[model samples]
Target: MSRKLLPDFLARAHDDRDPSPWLALWLDQSTPLPDPVKTAWLADSSSASRQYLLPFLRPLARTVIVLLQVVKVFFPRNWSHSGALHALLVWGLKRFVSPQANWLILRHFHLGSQVLAFIARNSPAPVPTSPLEPTDIDALRDDLFLKHDLNLFNFVIRLNQALRDQGLELHKPAHLDLTMLRDPDLKLEDMPHGRLNFLDLQSAIELFTPLYQLLLTDNDFWRAANSLQLDETIGIYCATLLAAPEHLVLVNNKHPLVPLSTLRAGHRLVIHGLSTEMLHALLMRFKQAQAEGGVVHTTSGDASAQ
Candidate 1:
């Protein structure tokens, strides 16, 4: 159930960006080799019938090595060297193996960990001594979403601060509509798709200004960017929402303020349409929260507080 909450955009993005051959080769070379025992055993033997015996044993050895690597994926540690050997063998096999197969394995392992991490971090806190009523759940859900948005807002503020520290500035364009950047019908020729070197200020601005705008203005796009920039944060947010004991349906309920539907819709719109001025205001709020060693709490009845 938690896994289902994992965003589809993440999976699509992962599939779309297949690593270049050069990157694959470099990654293979860069991975550390297994310890000496396995290397020595595979390197050669000095028995009388070694030539005939090794040919038969090599396949079994490779299989065992691969299995060990699969185990290491779950239990990462320095105890065994078989996993290292497995990596080397897999890397070697990439040259002869189908690219699709290699990509599938790499993509699954990498993306699986990301999902697991998201689940771990964002799983809901245990219910209090008194189990939460629907209203309590509603408040908690809204609070979590607010926290997630503010966290992203703070991150951008920090990024800007870092840039300033390095004598760089992030210019917020006067007219920015991120929705256009994400139009599915937009032609590839019109897209800013190319190699970018952030070290060059012009290149950085050309690439990131539009990207930052998109992050600010598009909820789906912002969530995807958050997933990439801060892995599983969005997943955790979704998971936390899904983990709510019961979905609030506030059609004719006696809530003091807005309906749950309105609250939800408005929250989404506010996050998606976040402007530079709003972000700066959020940054200030976050700083104050940090200085006070507490969070800025938003009441369930007052959506404006968020």
Candidate 2:
């Protein structure tokens, strides 16, 4: 079978809700098993002569074990114990223990990482690392301007208040999972390389709406500096996300009359509203800066001016 068939196969195999029919189908197709499954079967078999028989016996053994567990759970005395035990097992599997053993048995091979990749690609909602799209920005703008009847300036002020009220500091260093950036097994680089979609889009919007409002705000300082363009504003936001204090100084420094020291001290720099290009650029800059041992100092401007 094609590798493309793996996601559907695993999904059906692990459907726990109603697994009997799917398990039967999986067993029926065991004769000419998929390459991964067949290889795994042979590797685990004791003898070459028993290779063919292993395919039939393996899934049957699994089904019988599962059925026995199900039957045990049906008994009133065993129900509570079984349910509690199952819950504990799930918790342990997700948190404390590695899932490698379970994956080997469930997938008929040790392809847990591949299976996760397939599920991520086939998921109904997009992953969090995807970029922001133009429509998403437009919708956010409408929500702020039309629905809320709040101009960019007021919106930003409100966003600042909200941030302060919630005690969320925007200038803090961001934590990232580098593993999500690449797939070592497949030699795939930049794993999530696209515009934000569905769930990711919704989440990004929710998190950044306040920051977007801040960007759209028409402050006299930004207007005088002539750096109020969307791209430039977004660049500042990206810099903040990257913890690039130098870039923030470069962008915000345009308004020299507004003391840098006061702005740095009083205003909390924030990040939001990112496109694919914008996010990529930030990551590249961050890496480059780290490589060169660049030193970044916090903004020294007074916050009251912001």
Candidate 3:
């Protein structure tokens, strides 16, 4: 039975602009890759590939900066980070990167850190107590950027579906065709490992800003913060889907993800939203869920004892 879980599951308080709840729910609920071995293999392979490939890619990543430098010479002496170049880059991303892939990549950083923060909060062993500032979160982002390819993650999602079609159960062995990823309709949130919330633009910007500073021509970090409208659309769709009252009437129908936003008067910039206090809240919930036989694991295959 599809019972209504939390009425405010997707609703934020009128005064709250905090993006953690949606991001955490998405991380906690993203479909777990079917096998732990696959997870380890992904990490192992991605690490090796990055070590081999980054030397080549680093120069390509630098091409953006070179283009910007040339444009600066030909254009105004006062070309700013928030100027036409930034807009064109954002437009190109929207224009070229598959919408699904774009959403997946940007949200992955926020969700990835949420996964780490969840672990840091729940670890039986003591770890560092310092809050993750923007710089620290940037380090985490850079580490992750070097570790995994998004296409590999996308391929695993397809492989999981193929395994399911063959009646394979979770954690069981299976072999599948790699070509399934070529399907036109695959989406990141379609599988049933758990529920995912939605994407928020600001969350992506928080993690992306540092990389923008390091790789792109925007040496002035403060002025380069930005986001896409696609983030807002996906977020609204997911939030509204879960929050809809129609679920009461159509009890057996698959509920769509839903959306909403609450505007407030105060302004604050969240570098990386994960913090010590947020970790504390996540820890308490993790304990309660563990008591209830629900253990959180990452999509990269950090499984808990069942």
Candidate 4:
């Protein structure tokens, strides 16, 4: 009977409340990799049994489908770390937000209670309290994340404190990725897409900010920035200085450049559309720049700073 209703079983398991991803789930659980792995979207779609079964399921997983499978197996089996459930919900949000693989989190373990709380909190329209699963949905109604999301500085400070509480971290000079300045070689496959060509401050800095002697090259800079600036301490304020090429793209809000006004007070400037020599000089300038503002002094200072 369980096998007979396996589709519904998976639908409930995924919480997608739809059946589309269920047969894949069943095949996955029941079969080994070569077989389950080979099944594509079409194989699951063509069957009436599969189609009808989808409405009975929901796609609850947000991380790699594989991780949710692990979580599902663990959660219903009375796993201790219920917070992992919340992790999966965050994973699902990540999956929906960008199908790209940039982050390196393997499990992203959250406890189960956290998961239900998150679901209760993040429903497109809030659900009325469910007494049966009170902890699952309603508790997340606490208003913390929506109000005070952390930025790079604050996140780092909090992380340091967390490490201290755990007795793992020490006060030391922190490292960050620095090799983000160089442009990748321009080829048929190497042209800047909107995501790379236009940039946001945090993301752009992360990609180019090489950690522990990570270095960016001219090619990378070309691909990532419209222009480049170097702060005295190896801090950078690269900007998207040029209008994009007309033939390849249209200027949207995501143009791969920054306004001059956004540049920080402490930087060595390289103008847009510079000659190769100018760019080379800018590279030298960045090499000469110091590392960061200074060592993270104290979280108290960070709190006041924020």
Kindly provide the TM-score of model 3 when superposed on the true structure, using C-alpha atoms: 0.25
Q: What ranges in model 2 sit over 4 Å off?
A: 1-158, 177-240, 249-280, 284-306
TM-score of model 2 vs. true structure: 0.22
Task: Give the per-residue lDDT of model 3 (tens digit) for 16-98.
Answer: 56554433433353333222212222222233223454354445434544454455556544444433434443443343332
| TM-scores for all predictions | 0.19, 0.22, 0.25, 0.17
- The lDDT per prediction is 0.28, 0.29, 0.30, 0.24
Model 2: how far is 221 from its true place, Å?
17
Model 1 global lDDT (CA atoms, 0 to 1):
0.28
List pairs with backbone clashes in candidate 1.
none
Write down the TM-score for model 1. Answer: 0.19
lDDT of 1 at 134: 17
Candidate 4 C-alpha lDDT tens digits along 1-306 = 123222234434544565545455535522111221123222323444334532332221112233433444534333232243334334332332111111101100111112222222332222222111112222322321111112222333444455556665222122222333332221212112233222211222222222101122223222223222211101111111111111111112122234332222111111111112122223223323425444321110000000
Ranking by TM-score: 3, 2, 1, 4
